[model samples]
Target: MRGAHPRVVLGLHRSRYERRPLTAALDLGVRAIDTAFNYHGFTAHQRLAKVAGDLLPRLTLSTKVGYFPGPDGAPQHSLAPSRLLAALEQTNQALGRPPNLVFLHNPEVSLHAPADAAREALSQACEALADASRRGWCESWGIASWDPTPLPDLIDDTTPAPCVLMVRSGLLAGIGTLDAADELTARWRPSAVWGMSPFGGNAEDPVWKTVDPRMFLQEPTAEVSRIQAAFRVAYDLPSVRTVAVGTDNPAHLQEVLQALDRDTDTAMLLKYRKLLRERHAAINGSEARP
Candidate 1:
């Protein structure tokens, strides 16, 4: 798979029931996919296995570990070597092949749990992933989270370096505002940023509905759609190499691809960034710009 910047990867987080759209995306030039071990009741891997035989070699496949529903119907979180290895083997078996990239899903558990306990778990997880990379079960590994608090610790020289970091990011508008993208860029330039939740995880949200692209876009309303406006900001960030945008509808995915291609122009991206920061600052009543 090519490591091209400012490109989009098809996310399989919400496509538990459909696989045809995946092949459709590939036919439409999408070269990467992002999936999680526990997405859709721990069955997403099984579904992907059906198509892995023919298409996996041509795609950059990514999946996550760290959280999955147990037989008792409760979610289990473990970074112990045995458990982590077992999960990896199971996932690889389910997919009929190993993943191109693997991630530690929702590592924010480190931020919420006791410091010492969290570090122990994080350490074990890193060791397990390092072993996976060495054993040929996975090519590369990283962490995926909406929170950035634990990232600095995870990326320290003492730990196993992550080749990719997937996090929640988008235009954000007025909701779920965060300075993580800026912080991440400043501190960790080594890891490629893979952005998730490009449309704030809800494309039809009211916040975006109220936004008028005429205020920022050079061509006013005719140049970009609301969805494109949201994605442009994250894609323009220097550290962000890829943004995962998924849809169950082939037509919608095509539209998203068109938006990415059109809105990523350098001139429009600069204007969009300026306007988004100004709008966010006004909403939060802060003079500081992200």
Candidate 2:
């Protein structure tokens, strides 16, 4: 089941856990927070968990397991179900509360291994997460991956189906070619689909980095700010149930809200979607269809 909160989720991964930004976002009514166990030396999740303190019940807390802080404070990926279950225990012990949703972070690693081994590993992990949910460690379990192509294989349905799929979806970084063509319709769909990186992942683009968002709405021509164009595309997708934006700057968060609050121009969104589809198809050498 999806939570009753704003469709925009405040991602805590890049927020550095600064009290001011989180408090300000919460004040602005951002009730859903996304974080991971290895983010910022495993401190980001705890910091946000601490800051929310008494208000935890009112907020939706989603986190991921499978990556842990290594000896040098870098990430060490481990998707073993036993390790994941232990991680959840540690997470609860640290936060003194249960997370609403827990995800298997980047289980795509399993696909790189031998086929038989990969299937077993992924299946075991999913089963373990479902067990954790039964024990009240988390309400539901899902898989978060950069490669959505393997989602069908990972979710064999022998285990409990995932409630969400947190993946990349935006303009410029158009959802994968198959997704652009809407070919994954028959796969196991999630109850809540979350999209990240609305700015096309091009940090150096002048339009995304420096252009005023208002310019996109004000311009009479076909030009649109990269951020606005990206956000609009994400908003228009029927599969994406919510969008996650990460920033340490409270002011920027408010600005993002302003962009989201404006009415989405369906005609404009459709136009851009068509252009993006063709562009992506050209790059992939696939026929672009409406």
Best by TM-score: 1
lDDT of 1: 0.70
lDDT of 2 by residue, 29-80 (tens): 7878888888877775567667766667767888999887778878888878
TM-score of 1: 0.82
RMSD of each: 4.0, 4.3
What TM-score does each of the candidates earn?
0.82, 0.81
Estimate, for each residue in 1-290, the C-alpha lDDT of model 1 and write its tens digit: 22333378888877854658877777788878888888878888887776555777877889998886778977777666787778889989988888998997876654456666666667678778878989999998887876665555544445665678777765652222235555655554546878788777777779778975434344445656776656656565433778888777777767666655443446755555677667767887987454
Candidate 2 to truth, TM: 0.81
- How far residue 168's Cα lies from its native spot in candidate 2, in Å, is 0.8
Error of 1 at 126 (Å): 1.9
lDDT of each: 0.70, 0.69
